[model samples]
Target: IYTGVYADGVNQANRRKSRHEQSFVAPEWGWAWPMNRRILYNRASADPEGRPWSERKAYVWWDADAQQWTGEDVPDFEKTKPPSYRAPAGADGVEAIEGIDPFIMQGDGKGALYAPQGLVDGPMPTHYEPVESPFRNQLYGQQANPTRVEYRRDDNPMNPAPPEEHVDVFPFVFTTSRLTEHHTAGGMSRYLEHLAELQPEMFVEVSPALAAERGLEHMGWCHVVTARSVVEGRVLVTERLRPLKVEGRTVHQVWMPYHWGSGGLVKGDSANDLFGITLDPNVLIQESKVGTCDVQPGRRPTGAAMRQYVEEYTSRAGVTDAEYPPIVTVSDDIVTASEDTGTQEEEDDE
Candidate 1:
């Protein structure tokens, strides 16, 4: 911004000066930073005919007779360019750009509901069921995101997500998020006394119903397990993390902060470890926010016991001999709330 506006050559003589200090700078940042734009896409606040869309929201526009783009703010478009101007056929470089188009970076020189390029998945937005869900997609037969990439390795073994028999064993939905007191992973903040004092321990947030069902006490120890790993955290029984009714079944969700690690000044467990490797096609982003896990009321095992404990879960969950949920279409009979209640809901009585 400094280079674009207050560069070496743009002194008072070279640029037009503001009449008053009030007009020159914002009160929040009292220091006058020359040519600082308060808004982006200021051109959109006006109409293509060079008029404000409305008097209440006037921004940049063109004055055709003067043949200049003028407004309260400096023009993003070429100053001298008029609205009627059009780029010639096969014009390369800047000449290829259009006057009315505010977002020139786009291939169509306009906003797109569908991407023309750079989307690894597809051009248009399509709804895919979450990688882990208690319910199935009703609109289509496909139970989960078919495009989602799951990794299979000795170190990063994934859980049976959906359309699989064993998925029913690890019943609760879990999501990892941040707390107000610390930043993500808490690499630096956890070591500090002030911030760590505010949120002292790594804990899991659960609803009253979930706590009652699992026999978890407020501030008591609990183990959160996934196919990859097991993590122990203090259970925090809170009304904030409520259970939702999905497909006629009361589905419970647990919340945990990802700020903890196996090693720290305020050590507990790395909540991130409780996840398998699943990547988004385009960005290769893991669906880190939500997954499935069974919350047990007790501390997690260590070393060899930990491996045996995980095997016990997998063995109970019917993960025998490298079994995984295949990409498949689900029948409505197996996935309605009434039939899916605690299991699969067949039909709605209502």
Candidate 2:
């Protein structure tokens, strides 16, 4: 389906003409041009009296002598409406819009922290575990988010958590992010040698503590395990990641650059491959930023055999693909106990 909504006509002049016209279009088809300008409802910058918020930010104001509206910037008005006009209560259509409100596109007249209408799941942002998770929710009684998605396929198996255990065998939480030099998934980087050399291959970074625990050396391969999948990458051990004491337990984290999709010169499985398409309730952004996995020092098994390798870890964890990190506890004492124990031990041994 398509809707013919072109915000820009032939030129800037024509674009301005169309701006004064009311238009609606479907999501599938629309165009903004001459810079793809998209301004929020600019009219609300003015008070009901038609004066702008400030001279620097001034856009429009009422002209009492001329009995019309005037503005140095884009005049967001009917071109002649006076400032004294009052809207009746419960008025329908444009009149119902409060004079100070700008986001008329939304149902309500405010910049809502909780959007009651647009989003499907809910309005506020809630932290949920990704499909592949290593840690349960430390902030909530529920371990992984109850709403996280799980795929039953061979490519996507979910790891499970034991009872009351927020941390799992895949002890380190892993997240994939982009490198500034490489675009997302690394399509452009593949064609360019300079970018490829800078980040030649798929690598996962771990803290020195995790590297030592796993017997992984810098630039050596480390097998990252989750119930559904396994991928091996070169290791970069650094001090940047220290164990975080969450809920009285020391939690480790790992980092991976997700720019190595299959099409690149440095080809690898999509970091997104490990991610199931669960979305944030407010903005519908995929919950791909954080997840759980175990790390081991070794080359990962290849081809069909890799699946078997991951399955072995899942079996040892004694949980099914549907389960994840156990429920979170709300006690500050429980959360901080791990750190406290370490400190007390240090003091007592002294």
User: TM-scores, in order shown?
Assistant: 0.74, 0.63
Where does candidate 1 clash, by residue pair?
247-337, 248-337, 336-345, 338-345, 339-344, 339-345, 339-346, 340-343, 340-344, 340-345
How does each model score on lDDT? 0.74, 0.64
Candidate 1 TM-score, C-alpha based: 0.74
- Output the lDDT of residue 181, model 1: 85
What is candidate 2's TM-score against the reference?
Answer: 0.63
28-144 per-residue lDDT for model 2 (tens digits): 223343223234455677776777788776655767788776554444445555555455877765675555555666544456768666765457756654545545555554444
How far in Å is the alpha carbon of 292 misplaced in model 1? Answer: 0.8
Query: Which 10-residue span in candidate 1 carries the lowest summed lDDT?
Result: 23-32
